[model samples]
Each structure stands twice: as C-alpha cells, then as structure tokens.
Target: MERLQGKPFPAGYNPEVEHVAFTREPLYFAHRLLIFYVVVKCAQLMGHGFLLLAGHRRYVTPTHNLTYWHRPCQQEEGSIKQPPLLFFHGISPGIWFYIPFLTRLGRGREIILLEVPHIVTQLSFEAPDRIETVQSLAEIFALHSISKCAVAGHSFGSIIAGWAATAFPQHVKQLVLIDPVCLLLCLPDVAVNFLYRSPPTNLFHRTLKDFIDPSSEITVSHALRRHFWWYQNICWLQDVSCPLVVALSSEDDIVPSTAIHYYVQRHYRMQEAVKHEKEDDAGEMTDQSNASGSGRLIYWRGIGHGQMLVSLKAQDRLIAAICKQAVESGLATRAEDIKNSGQKNLRRSRVTAA
Candidate 1:
C-alpha cells in the first residue's frame, strides 16, 4: 500500500486523476454469511442450466488450470465473418447474472467465457500469479486451436484480458474493455473505492457494503490484500498493439473515468504525432491512422460499474464494437475453416468440472 501511495503523480499526471489523500483500513465490514454463498451456489446451478440450453459447452484446461464456457455460432449464413470472443468475468454473485449479457454476444458468432472463481463463484484463498495465469492462457489457446481472437473483459476481468494482449500479442487482435478497473490503476480511485474508503451508513449503503466491502468475501479480500500487484494489473494505452474499444462508465466509482479520458486523449495525440513523423520521414503513407486520431473511445453517459450487463442499449453497443474489431482483425473468417478442420473441439457435457 505504501509503495503504491507515492507523492505528486510522477512528472506529468492528468489533473483529473490526481490522487486525493488516499488512506487504508482493511476489513471495515465482515464477510457475508455462509448462507449467502449457499444462495450463490444455487444461482450458479441455474446459470449452468441456462448455459446448457444456450449451447455453451464447458471445458477445463490441462491440470485444471482454468474453467471456461464455449458457445459456437448457431447461424452461419450471410457475409458475417468474425473470430471467437474470449471473455472474463469480474466479481459478482454468479455466472447466471451475466447469461443475458453473454448470450447476446453469442448471436451469430462464437463466444467463450472465462470463469474467475475467486471473485464470485466460491471462497478460495488461491490467486495465481501473472506467469502462471498467462501460461494457462497459452494452454487455453492451444486446446481450442485458436490462432487469434478478440478479447473482451469487464471490471477486474479486464486485467486478465489485458494479459492476453500484452503477453501474447500474436494471438489477440482486438480488445473490448467495459468499465475496466485495470486502467489508470496508478491513481488512488480504484484502491479507495474498492478497498479503502468506506461508504456512509444508510439503508442503501448497508446493501452496497454486502458486496463491495473488502472483508465481505474471503476470496476477494485475499485477492486484494495478499495478491493484486498493481504493476501486474495496470495496463496503459501504449502497452497494447491491437485495436482497442474502451467503454468507460459515466459514473464509475472504482476508477477515475474523467481522468482516464484525458489521459487517453493525450496518448491519442502522441500516437498521431508519432505516426505523422514516421510518414513524413518514410515519404510514404503506411498503415495510416485517422487524422483526428481519437481511437474508439466510448463514454457511457449514465452507466455505472457493471451496469451494462443489465441495460439493453449497452449490450447492443458492446456487441457492435466487438463485431467491428473482429471483422477488422479478419481472424474469425478462419473460424469456420478451423471448425471444419477437425480440431479437438470440446465435447458437450452436462456435468462440467468446477
């Protein structure tokens, strides 16, 4: 915590994201009761059933490295072409809450859901390091025979989706980050909102604390306190090489959305300037980006953290962005060919490994 809390936002920091006297006092509220987890487990069963009906097959990687859900395209007509979508879930009650969101993305395209048990599924103290987790991603890619894919993640899941882009650049073509907590992590907003700062005592606050309180979930607490290295979690604009679709909520309490917008705008300017200089020097226009150079930056006017899962408009927007990136990458055109090529696609099973 002390290492993260430094003075005077580096040489140049976006004024919007400037740190605001961040302080810490862990476990302000106790974890939820065991009955709450029991309720969550029941909800997971419901979600599992819904997924089966939706044609999502479950698979576990070698040595149980990861548990994921894969849903192939049901409709292959028309000129629709895209690559598979690899997605990660953030801390929530269970997967069932997200089936509505995930099912929409599954329309006319293949989608894969990466599960994060530490966040929402169950109580566990184990949180893998970056190296081990990235290796697990490699295993996931090889198992599915995916040469390239578009990765979309929400909340803390964005951190892992980012890993695929940075660790295996050749494999990831586009990124769709929805209300990501990983960006601008150097700032104190995320730590304060998610961990340190306490909400006011009230009827709504009482309900809110049940979920966001660091000590409310043992696994989440451990992940935040024992693991969660910001250096490993933090992802900047320059770190990725793929076309990025960053969806920032208007009212995100965890991260500084306004600050991130300014920071990204600055980077966009830098990116355009660098491109222009290279073109001028080479005396040829090559891989020319937009002159305005504002990359696909979507700012949700009223959405808050994880609110897109419930809003129909937000879902459609996310689908369109994902499809656009997938088409641009042209990696999914080969998806059908790969499916026909007879790779060991996951077998449909009712009972999946947890």
Candidate 2:
C-alpha cells in the first residue's frame, strides 16, 4: 500500500469552466427508454406516486446532519469556517451504510449525504446529466448558505462526485474518489456493451415480488448504462481541479487495480517532473515536497473496493485523509490537531464496531 502526494493528470483541466460535447449513439436512446420503462414500472408497483410526478425536481433542501468536535484553538479566533462536505454514496443498501463514517468524519463540521434521486424516486436516468446533478446539489448547498464545500464519492457515487467537481470546480473545495468503477480499466469493451444490454443475474430480478423494492431493478439498470457511458467518455477526469484523494482497494473485483495504478503513477510522474523543473531553475537540491495539494493516492491492502465505508480501520484512514485535506486546503489550521480530534472519535467507534 502506498500514500503519496502528486497532481492529477491532464493538469489545468477544470470541469466547471471547460465545455465538452457528449455524443450518444442512436442505439443508446432505445436502451435508455427500456431502462426508463423498467424504472417506471418498478415505481408503480412500489406504490410511489410522487416519483410519477414529472418535470425534474430542481430544488432540494437537504437536512443538515451536523456533529460538533474539538476544533483547534487557532480556529477559535474567527477564522473563516471551513466549507462543509457532501458525500455521494455507492450502489448499496443506501446512505444508512455510511452512518459510521459520517459520525466520525463529520466531526467539527457538517457532512451532507445526497441520495441518488433515481435510486428512490421513479425518475428517468436519460433526463439527467452530470451537470444537472451538480445543479441539484448546488440548490441544497444554497439552502444552507454554503457557497463552497468539498465533495466525496465512492464506487458508483465517485462518478457523480467527479462530475460535480468538474462542473462546479469553484464550489468544490476538495474531491475524494474511492474505488471508482468508471475508469473502465477492469472491463473490456465487449463486456461493457453486453452488460448494458443483458445484465447479469445479480442485477436482474426474475420476479417483481423477489425485489427488495421497485428501485432495486432501476438502480441496477442505471448502473449498467452509466458505467457503459463512462467507458466511452473518459475526458471528465482531466478537468477536475480541486485537491483530490483516490483510495483503491487492491482486491477489488469490479474496478481493475491496474487502472487505479495507472492513475496514481501518472500523477506521480507529473509531480516528479515539476519538482525537477524547480531544482533546475534554482540550480540546487532541496527536500521532497508534499503532493497532497494536487492529488494523493492511497492503496488499501485488505479492503475491497468501497468496503472502507463500513470497515473500522479503513474508516480511520479515510477520516484522517479528510482531516488532512481540510488542513491542506486551509480549511483547518493544523493537520495534527484535526487528525487528533478524529482519532479520539475513532477510538470510541471501535467499541461500537466490536
């Protein structure tokens, strides 16, 4: 496992400012319609009428789940409070799965959990783009008078979080992507196309009664299409500008470990080149520099993909990273101070997890 500072590849790419055209194949329309039909049918069977109401709901007021912890004394002197954080969760049971990390990582600040609306609501995946997701989050941020905040996403959620960071660079102070599946390194072209059309048994339900809920089928369908799109359009990552931390599980079965390594090594090379350039200009040697500002890659040994959210030790590392990011971004005064605060909570959490 390795943890190091470096810059993300394709530097100077800010998704919010750049304009990129998204071209969908004509066949995709048919695929999208079929997914929409499944979603609508599921919602109907579940007896959710609100989801049936059309015209994309733009404004959302997210409930603020805040937890207070010890802040560094330096922060008490009226320094600008650090922006809050918003978390986008992966495809799983739901946001409930993230409660452990939320309580620990959210200490001394606010952490927002935004549910993928389509997962619960009978919404069509075709109607929304990454920009719309960002806007929807912006509405929630505005409700709390938060002009800027960090964003984190895990697995499937990482794609949305990355898009949000790309579309709203100024608004996102930092970005955390964990075990992202959209990198398209693990699966082949044939596999992605096949999965999109004919999903695996894990994704499909033989009977509506067998489903946990109507949204179950829709979530799986959406995942297939979303991942397929990612395989085609890989330019989004080039535009992310804020501080980034990518955590990869070596044993991940979904996203190829090679893809994660490629991403980390690319940034590592970029940072090294920059350091050399500095030395050449100064005509002297110097100590190493921290790459946390540009990007940081964390390789998790035992953890599998997004499992860090639920695991105790992995969550400890994640909280430390979040606190470290706060300091790096000037959101906090001292990395050690914030880290200590989170550590104390982590100790208490150990008892709960046991």
Candidate 3:
C-alpha cells in the first residue's frame, strides 16, 4: 500500500496527495485481508448510496408540506408586506446550517429557502443539471405567484441562482450572489484537483466512485462539477439582463477574490452605470432614481465562503441590501411602466389638441 502525504497547494496546505491508489495486500492472512476489504468497501458504498437517495429527495421544498414560519418585516408596519427573497444554500452540510442567517433575514422578508436537490441525500454532480433543477424550482415558485422577487444564492447555490435568473428573467427582479462558485474565471489546476481529491467522504472513495458512476452520475456530476464549469458559466453571465448584487469575501479558500472581481467587473460592471443613471435622473425622477439604485456590489474583507452566511452581522447587511434592492427594482420597473403610460396619454392629448 502507498502512503498519502501532505502538500502545499494554492487554496491551502492539504495532507492528502492527489490521485493515490490503494491495493489489497497479499500475505499469510490473505483470506482475512480480503474479507476485511470487502466489508469496508461494501459499507462505504452503502453509506454513499443512502446519502445520495436522501439528498435527492430533500433537495427541494416539498409541495405538500404546508407549514412554513413567517415573520413580519422590520421596515413595514402592520401593513404586513415584505418582498420575497429566495435563498439557495451551499454544498455539503445542509440548509439548517444557515439558521443564523435565515433567522436574521426572516425578521423582515418572506424567505423561500430552495434546497439544492440531492445535496444531502445523494452524490454531487455537474453544474448544468444543478442549474436546471434550480430553474425548475424557480418555475414552481412562479407558478405559485412568486414573481418579481430577489433571488440569492451562495457558493454552488450562486451558480444555480444565476441560471435561475437567466432562465426566468421576469421572476427574478434582482440577484444576490454571495461568494458564488461560478464567478471565478480561472482556478489553479492544483486547487481543482484538491477539491476533487477530498470528495466528501474520507473513510473510502465512496463519494468519488458514486460521482463517477455512470448509472447515478448525472445529478452527482452536476453537483460536484463546479470547477469544470466555473469559467463557462462566468462567460454566460454576459447575457443576463436583470440587475445583480455580488457580495464577495476576500478570505474565501474555495474561490479567490481575483476571480470574483474579474467576473463582476467584466460581466456586470458592479452597477456603476445603474448608479450613474440613477444619479443623473435624481432631480427630475426621484422615484426612478431610487429604483435604479437597486443594483450593487459589496466586498466583505475577512469572511470565508462558509462563514459569510453564518455571521449575524453579515446576514443583517445582506438581507438589508437585498430587501432594499428588491424594493428599488420594483419601484423602478413600475415607474417605467407608468412613464410609458404617461407617454401614451401625452400622444393622445397632442392629437386631440391638434
């Protein structure tokens, strides 16, 4: 058997070597060794299969489950009106991990936490399928009258959110991407290899094997293939029209700040034009300007990919910005509609006067 050793990589110092193979030893106790290996391997496979099944079933909110906790918005009075902010949790772990952030945001907005399909119950897969699954969930929300709301996603969830916004442009008025996985244009090969090597399960190569398994690989690939599609999806962001708010963490190990900055600057422009347009129309169009100020990009200095949503302060800031942006976008969109109506009225008035 070959021993795995630690090595320094771009993301961090990992103790495991990349692509090391293990073999069953042959000796006086060959029969015992074979039995032990088979037992261990079977256990690993069973565990992975169980997780895969659970993850697939729990990925989305069940349509039949009716109980959902609700809290009135802090910004509103007895009016009881709050913009829905759809949230997507990151990989591994589970949505319950975000209770801190969710509790904070729940104080003001009706948060729809869309769990990534099969993340907890099944093996991870490629990015495209994950995107498709999220898009389907977004459509479900729209079918239930969840139109013109702010959509937020973190890490891998961010990629899903981006696809959701792009796929259903009318449903998502604004987007809040927190330390997104796909925004990074280029990642070091070492980092990508490190991510793949870790492979959720450390006891055996179960997670890795399941992910590569042809029978169950599609969903697993969509969930685990983040590094491969990072650049491809970032490039695809150029086609998204809805205003975006990208909150990046400088201390993220999984994704570098340089990559986030590049995509935000290159593709979305960090709301510079929108802000400028708002400022330009400030005097003549106060409501319109306020609405145009919806798009924003925020950079948090010392937060990691996982810690960004765990912090109370971070959650507060994120929720506040998202709520404000949603309101502003709605106001702006409505103002434009009204402006068009006024233009039509003026045209009629002119014809009548003439």
Candidate 4:
C-alpha cells in the first residue's frame, strides 16, 4: 500500500495505482467534501460564539443618572499605588476577545475597562447621546476617585480616548491609541463612500450576518446602530490636546496609514501653536515643555489590526513606553499638585475664553 505523506492507506486507495476504483472515488470525494464543510461550519460557529460573548456584561457600575458595564482588570494583592489604565475597546467582537492581553497587562496594576453603550445592542449606531455618554463616563471616573489615569483606546475607541483627553485633560495623564481611525486623512473613495451611503441597518445585517451568523440579527443591529458615534469620533480626535502615543499597524486594512500620518501631522502643527503662543512670554515655556511632544508614532511591522492586542512582543514594547511616560508625569507632583494643576488650567481656560 502506498502512503499519502507517510500515512499508510488501504492498498486499493493508493494514488500510484494504474487505474482508480469507481466505488472508492465517490467515497473519497464525499469524505473530502464533508471535512471541508465541517471545517467551514465550525469556523462560522466560533465567530458567532465570540460575538455573543462579546456582548455579555462583565462589570457594572451605576451612578445616579447613568448605568454602564465595563470589564474589570485582574488586580494583584498589595498593589495600592498602581496607576490605573483605562482601556476603550474597538468595534468588533467586544473587549472579551482581549481578555488574555488585558489580564496580562492588568496584573499588579489597576485597569478600568470602558464600555461604549449599545456596543452589542440593537441601537449601537444611533448614539444620539454620544457626547453625554462620554461626559457621564468622566463623571463616573471622578466619582470613583480616579484623579489621573492612562487612557488607551483601540480603533474606534481611540476616538473616545481622544475626546476624553481633550474634554478632561486633567484627568487623563497619558493617552495611548492603537490603529486609530483617523477619518480626516485621505481615505479610499470606495471605503468612504461605503461608510456614507450604507445605512446602519443594511450594513449591520449584511456584514455581521455574513461573517457571524444569520441568527445574530439582534447583535448585528445593535452594533450597526452605533455607526453615528463613529462619525462623531472623527471630530473629537481633531481637538485633542493631551500627550498621545499612537500605534499604527503596518498591515491595517480598515484604517489607512495615510490617515494616521495626516492626524499626527495635524497634531504636530498644533504643538507648534503652543510653541508660538509661548514665544518669549518668559513664564511660558518651549514647545517641548508640554508633554504632547512626548507624543510618539509607533509602527508595528507585520501586525494586523486585531493581532496587536495578542502580540506579546508588541504589547511589551508599547506598554513600557506608555507606562514610563505616565510614571514620569505622576512623579513630577504629589496628589495635591495634580489638583492644583487642574484648578490652574480651568482658570486659564476660562480666562482665555473670556
């Protein structure tokens, strides 16, 4: 009997035979087709299972006016002074998908997971209260006594991170963005057109149903309903002033690299504005004085959008840089210093507006 790749088969099934058997051929074909179908079905089932799990609530925090669910970080004992890292998840299979990565990062540190409303619900894209959602989150943090923390967001979540940093700069000391969706840069016309023309209903039903399962109709509708929030996120990024560390995946297909570069350039130019405004004001410092230039753009070669979370090597390097900056900023002052700085900044902003 001949073997296929060293696995022995029955004598009649050998490929070296002069003639193929009629009865055996049909059986072989059927077996191959069955294997293929089963593999495909398993893959589909797995995808749907992930989507459903992503929608499940992991942590719930309630205040007087709002209620939200977030993934809680796994904390180690005796780590009181550990800095808090807030993670804002992306648009796909919810934060649950990144549990392994988050669990690793959360060890010996404080981590807060922020959940965008309607993420897995049927109203995902119809975020009429988008701004209020973020504001409420900020208030939640304040109520929870999170004075200053590192804010990190992935993809669509980056928009939220950027907005939070700008709206409440005092609270967010470090900003980390991964494969951010910079809508301002030159986007492929087809992609942009697709985003503009496709209603959330059609998009949710088509893409989610095809990739996930037809039975995931409710989940699909919920994710699609939040499409408007994605649009608002673009505007939020433009006005962000916090020191930012952006990681761009070299192989990202959903977000173009050009857009990322454009956003960095725009923010760099804003840094220049800070420099110009301070020219010889004596009390004012150089452009480098602000932590914004601590701003960095890191490119991860061969990493796809989703893989960045799971890549141990990539996460190590990225997290190290982010934590280093956070520590430096944190050490520069005690708790009182942070409070005073916040008060001074508030007064300065009001004066400027007047």
Clashing pairs in 1: 82-332, 83-332
Q: Which lDDT tens digits does candidate 3 get at residues 128-209?
A: 3544565456545755567666677877677768777777777776777887766644555213432433344564566554
Using TM-score as the yardstick, the better of models 3 and 4 is: 4
lDDT by residue for model 2 over 1-354, one digit each (tens)? 123446445537656662221224222211234565575566444432321231112223333222111111123333334567777766654454555576566555555666664443234354345545656666665666767787888876787787777678667878888887555533453233333324336534533323433323554445444534554334244466667777888877566766667876686677667667877888753433233325667788976656777788887886677667667666555545666778999999998999
Q: Which ten residues in a row have the lowest lDDT in candidate 2?
A: 65-74
- Tens-place lDDT per residue, model 1, 84-178, is 78888888776677788877776767778888777764776567777877888888888788887778888889999888888988888777788
- When 1 and 4 are scored with lDDT, the better candidate is 1
Between prediction 3 and prediction 4, the one with superior lDDT is: 4
TM-score of 2: 0.60
Task: Report the error of model 3 at residue 224, Å.
Answer: 1.6
Error of 2 at 184 (Å): 4.4
**Total backbone clashes of candidate 1, pairs 3 or more residues apart or in separate chains:** 2
- Give per-model TM-scores: 0.80, 0.60, 0.57, 0.61
With a 3 Å backbone cut-off (N, CA, C), the pairs that clash in candidate 2 are 5-291, 16-166
Please list the residue runs of candidate 1 whose C-alpha ends up more than 4 Å from where it truly belongs after superposition: 1-29, 203-208, 211-215, 283-294, 328-354
Off by over 4 Å in 2: 1-82, 120-127, 184-216, 226-228, 231-237, 275-294, 335-354
Highest lDDT among the candidates is held by which one? 1
Q: Please identify which of the two predictions, 1 or 2, would achieve the higher lDDT against the true structure.
A: 1
lDDT (Cα, 0-100) at 316 in candidate 1 = 84
Answer with 1 or 2, whichever has the higher TM-score. 1
